[model samples]
Target: MAALIEMREIVKIYPNGVVANDGVNFSVDRGEIHALVGENGAGKSTLMKILYGMERPTGGEILLDGQPVHFHSSNDAIAAGVGMVHQNFMLVPSFTVAENIVLGQEPLRNGLLDQAEALRVTRELSQQYGLRVEPEAVVDSINVGMRQRVEILKTLYRGAQVLILDEPTAVLTPQETQELFAAVRKLVDQGKTVIFITHKLREVKEISNRVTVMRSGKVMGVVQTEDATRESLARMMVGRDVFLQVNKPPVTRGKKVLEVHNLSYVSETGRTMLHNVSFNVYGGEVLGIAGVEGNGQTELAETLSGLRPAATGTASVNGKAILNTNPRTVRLSGVAHIPEDRLTNGLALTASIDENLIVDRYFRPPFHRGLFIDYKVVEKQSADLIQEYGIRTPNGKLPVKSLSGGNMQKVIVAREFTSDPALLIAAQPTRGIDVGATEFVRDQLVKQRTDGKAVLLISADLSEVMSLSDRIIVMYEGEITGVFPDAASVSEEELGLYMLGIKRQTKEEMEAVL
Candidate 1:
């Protein structure tokens, strides 16, 4: 039988002489969940963009059901039963789920929008596909996982026969990811084709029928899911034997570095967001904070880092007060924070790589000579860090926005990790990056612990927390639900129960977190 979709000799070259895709060929069988796996900027995104009509390929021919077709825009792709859900959702904040799902294709009743019909059609479509969601819920009020479901439902409602999901599980917790996998299987069983683009190998093995590995703008290999081992797949994606394990050093707990004594935070609307949260990180230890997204994890990190003020609590870094202080004061006191959303808070995208690397230390003595900025010193340091952290960049003089997602993250990792911080607050350090980059980030965090620096790692990725954390804590609904003294002793199932608010720790265990 002919394939459901095919791209013949795809080639895309930008105006800046960057060839994103070169002589690439791709296809997907009807009603199969096909995975497109690669490192960041390895041409997977570019290929998908070409397929979805988001970009006009410099040279390529797309065959749908064995007939040559051309798409001028996403509208053309949509009309041909193709749909894509981006990493950042595009739903309006004040709209309801049903309204957002059927926005452009709304039903009209005598020259008026039919609200009742929208809800009914959305419910029927969601129930038919087993992608359940609250149709009346406000889009902004829902969590990330739920919002993602709405996106999928919208695509299905629009009669999409082929679905493209970009890093679907990047922000989901363990349990939510399981649910998404179930939904993917359901969609495939119902005769829909799915193209999953991601950097996670485990998910590829778990969900895809066939895996296509791309690297450096070309297809590396293609194999059946049953025959592809994670190791073999990693080799294809990165052209190396990628090691995912972290060789942690021996236990050497030292003095407390960060102490949060009954920290409580409230929002501007006067809603108490964080409970009396209390935790302590000792030197030479990594305390992993595990929680579902929106479970007060963001608030906790912001409050501790001085981005958000605490309502009633005391936090000290190295026995010095940090509560209610600005981010500069906290950083000057020997703290380094890697915020969850890097593009917004981490770096200035338009600035040169060297300029961004020196943002935190520009006023320091070594880089500042007689109140004049030292460009040579800055470039030398940035080049050293680029080589040290394996940042794949042509030069430090290039703007940071020119690099791929993984390389951009490496820049942040190098800057913060090399600062010799007394306490490092790494929040989702490898959330959307590739497998190789994730491994490198994990190693750097482990190295910091070995060097006797306290680390507070907050991540929704359970496997990341399990592998790198010496101890683990589960947060749910603005409170710590469980604290595992030894991270290895607890199972993901048990931890997930706490994350879902199905289980709770005893009062004594909560007190022991300090």
Candidate 2:
């Protein structure tokens, strides 16, 4: 059979002289789910963006059904039966699922939108595709998994024959992920093609028919799923053997390092973001918080890190109340924070790598002489960290923006881990980095726990939570729905139900351990 889509010798060069894609060749057959696996800066997203008309390739052409085509914009690609669902959902929160789906092309009767027809069509699509979404449910009121279903349905409703999904399972639980695989198979059975882009190697093995690996803006190889293992795929992507499982020793609980009681946060809009939240994190143990993206995780991280203040609660770091204090005060209290968005909250991109590494320590005696920063000490610290962390950089004096995503993340992790803090707050610490970097970060977190440091880990990736935490807590709608003193007690599927608010532990069960 002829290929459904083919991209030949694709090359993309940015104005800053970054070659995102270099003479790449990729193609997919009809009714096949092709997996694109790569590191953060490996050009998988850029190549797909070019195919979806989000970016124009500097050199190359896309052929659809054996015919060369040019897409000036996303509209052009959509008109040609291609659709993309980004990692972040793009939906109007106030709109219902049906209205959001039919926003661009709604059925009309008597010069008005035909709401009845819209609901009927949505019902039919949901049934036909096995998406299982409620037509009238408002987007804001739905969970992350349901919102993802709405995105898939929207693409199918737009007459998309080739669907491009970027990090579809990044925010889903194990059970929801199984359901999505079922829907993907259904789409393929109906003769549609799917291109799945992800950092997850296991998902590729579970749901894809073929796997393609890319590295440094080039295709390394493509192989049948049956012929690929996580080890093999990872090796292709990163040029070495990578550990898929996190190695951790048994937990030995130590002194209590963090305590929060009746924590409540109200936003500027007078909305209660967190309600009666309470937990304890101890040295030599990592406390993992698992939830969908918007389920008060951000507020909790910010409040605990001194970026936001809780309305009604008391929180202590190392037996001292540090609520509402500035970051410097929190650091002085022997606390370190690895925020969720590395680019935004972790680093100053334009600053030199040396400068970024010493921001928290520049005022110290050794690094600071009188009123001026000691350049010799700064240079030594930067060189030591770069060597110890294995950061791939030409020099410490170069701007941080010159480094790759994984290296930039290493700089943050190295600095935070070396701070000798009693408490560490790591929120999505390895979100978009590669397999190697993720393994390193997880090991570092476990190392801190092993060294008698308290860790609070907040992540959307359920696997990270399960593998690293000594205890697990599930949050939904700003409330603690369940708590497991043992991380191994609940399966990912069981934990996902609580994440979606489908099931909740009794008050007795949650209160005793939490």
Candidate 3:
């Protein structure tokens, strides 16, 4: 088969002198599911951007079906039947699924948008591709998996022949991932070409026919997926023997660190979000909270961290009541929180890295002298934290937004971990980070446990929850439905049942773990 897309010695360099792609020779066969796998900072995204016309290659030639071509912008690439779906969804929150699908290329009747035609096309595409999304549902009201399906549908609706999916499975649950893989297979069977970009080797092995590996702005190698092993891919990407399993000694539970009693809150719509949620976390142990997203997990984390006002009940750190208190008070009471969303809740993106590092402690000594800001001390401390956290940046003066997703997360972790609080609230700590960073973050949590710091670990990644958690609490409809002491012994299927409110445990069963 002739190649659907081809790049010959593509070279891309930014104005900052960072060479993202260098002499990258890549190609994808027509109607094939090709995967691009690499670690953070690799040229995978760069190469894809060049192909999709989001970026202009500094050098090299691109050919489509053996014909040379140049794409000056995304519109040009789209006109050539190429489309890209970014990691972060680009849909308007207020727009309906059907409206988002036909945003740029809406059907027209006379001079106005043809709503009937849009809905009909959306429904036809949904039925044909098995993407069962309600055309009328608002984007914000749907789950992440459904939103991703919408993204795919949007591209397909635009008559895209070559689809580029960037980190598609990063946010999906196991079952949702399976569905997406099935959909990818269907698309390929229907003679569509796909270029999947991801760092997960398992997904590559499962879905890709051929895989191209890139590392540090260079193409490492390309091989058939059937011939490549996870170890081989990891070594090619990182140039090391990566330890997939996190090594931690058995946990020794100590004194009580954090306790929540009958914590309940109400949503803006006057409905109870949490009801009598009670749990206790001990020093030297990680208590994992597992639930489907929007099941009051966000509310619970906010209430416990003093980011949201608890409607009823009390939460305490080291026997000190913190419910209804402000964030500063919570921090002073021996609580440190690693918020779920790093951009909105955890960081000031426009601020310098040094300022973000000292955000939690700017008022304390060393960072502050009476009423004056201590620039020297702050700079030194930020430098030390940056080194300790392995943050990759030229200097602390750079804005936090300049760093990659993993590096930004490192800054947040460095700030919170350096505080040495008695109770740590880590919510989705490894979300959106690469595999290496995920392992590092997990190791840090284990180290905190070893240091006798109680951790309330709320994560949507079931594997992470099962691996690091000393105990597990499953939430359903804003309430604790089941508690398990042996995290490794529990099955994902069983957790899914509790998460979906299909199963529940009696108060006696829950009390034993609590």
Candidate 4:
């Protein structure tokens, strides 16, 4: 079959001389789900952005259905039946589902908005595409899965024949993911082509008909999905045999380094985000917090890390009070935190990489001598860490914001892992990084555990929590719904039950292990 869309010799060079895409060629079939996989900075996103008219190619030509075309803006791409759903959902919180769907192209009756027609159209599209949604439900009040369906419906309502879904399943639970896969298959069966960009190799294998691999701004190869193993695809993307599994050896649990009892948090808007949450992280073991995103995981991490004040309850590190204290106080009590939102909580974007490396310890002995930071010592430490952590950058003096996402994450890891803390609170440590970086970070977490340091791991990735934790706790709404004394003894499906509030253990059952 002839290609439905072809991008030939695409090249994107930023004004700062970064070659995002280098002589790349990509194509997709008319009704197939095609996956694009690559390491961070491999230019997969740039290529797609060019195709979607978000970026102008430095050099290339695009052909759609054997006809040459040029899209100067996203509006042009939309008019040509192309649409993109970003990793972050773009919806107005106050708008109803039907209103969000027909936002820019609302139906009109006598120079006024046609509310009835909008609901009718949304219902029609939702049923026709096999994506279920409530047209009248407010976007803010809906669940993540329902919000995603509304996004797809929005694109379809705009007459999109081709869809680009970026990291669609990043924040979805196992059950919600299956539903999305079913919906995607239905779309393809009804003649819609899809281009899926994701970091999860398993999803690539499961949802894609064909796969294209890229490395360092170039296409490595493209192959039929049935012919590719996860290992093979990972190797192609990173140019090495990446370990898809964590190599964690058995270790004896040690003294309790972190203790929390009835920890609770209420948002400024007066909504209860955490409720009576309790757990313990012992030295030489990892205690995993497993749940779907927005289910009190963020609040718990922030409260423990001193970023948020607790409404009720108490927490401590090594018997020193940490709850409701400031960040520096918690850090002084032997706590190191890798926050979930790296940009906001992890780094000072305007600071140089070397400066950021020492933000947590800038006022200490060697670096701080009589009120002046010793730049020479800081430079040496920064140089050593950059090499040790495999941070790719031209120099240590560049601002943290100038680096790619993966490198910025590496900087955070390098700083936190080397802090020598007694307890590590790692929240989504490897969320956006590639397989190689993920492997490194996971190994480091295990290393910390084996070295007799306590680790409190909170992640939305089920495989990550299951593989690394010695014990696991499941949260639903604002409470601990289930607890497994042995992480290895539980299944992903069983955990999903607690995550979706389908199952809950009595307070006595959870307290026994928690």
* lDDT (10s digit) by residue, model 2, range 369-404: 998999999999999999989899988999998998
How far out, in Å, is residue 203 in model 4?
1.2
Q: Which ten residues in a row have the lowest lDDT in candidate 3?
A: 169-178
Tell me the tens digit of each residue's lDDT in model 3 across 1-514.
7687889999999999989999999999999899998877888888999998989999999999899999999999988999898988999989999999999899999988898998999999998988879998999888778999999999999888999999898656667788899999898888889999986787889999999989888999999999999888887887777776777788789999888899999988798989999999999999999887778889998988888898999888888999998999999998989999999999999999999999999999988998899999999998898888899998999999999898999999999988989999999998877777777899999999999899999998777888899899998779999999878889877887787677899999899868
All models: lDDT?
Answer: 0.90, 0.92, 0.90, 0.93
State model 1's lDDT: 0.90
Best by lDDT: 4
TM per candidate comes to: 0.96, 0.96, 0.91, 0.98
Q: Give the count of colliding residue pairs in each prediction.
A: 0, 0, 0, 0
Q: CA lDDT of 119 in candidate 1? A: 95
Clashing pairs in 2: none
- Scored against the true structure, residue 75 in model 3 reaches a CA lDDT of 91
**Which tens-of-lDDT digit does each residue in 1-514 have in candidate 4?**
7799999999999998999999999999999999999998999999999999999999989999989889999999989999999989999999999999999999999988799999999999999998999999999988888899999999999899999999999888898888999999999999999999999999998999999999999999999999999999999999999999899999998998999998989999999999888888899999999998888999999999999999999998889999888999999899999999999999999999999999999999799999799999999999999999999998899999998888899999899989999999999999988889999899989999999999999998888999999999998888999999999998988888889999999998888777
The local lDDT score (0 to 100) that residue 251 gets in candidate 4 is 93
Residue-level lDDT tens digits of model 1 in 338-397: 989899889999999999898889998789999699888998999899999998888999
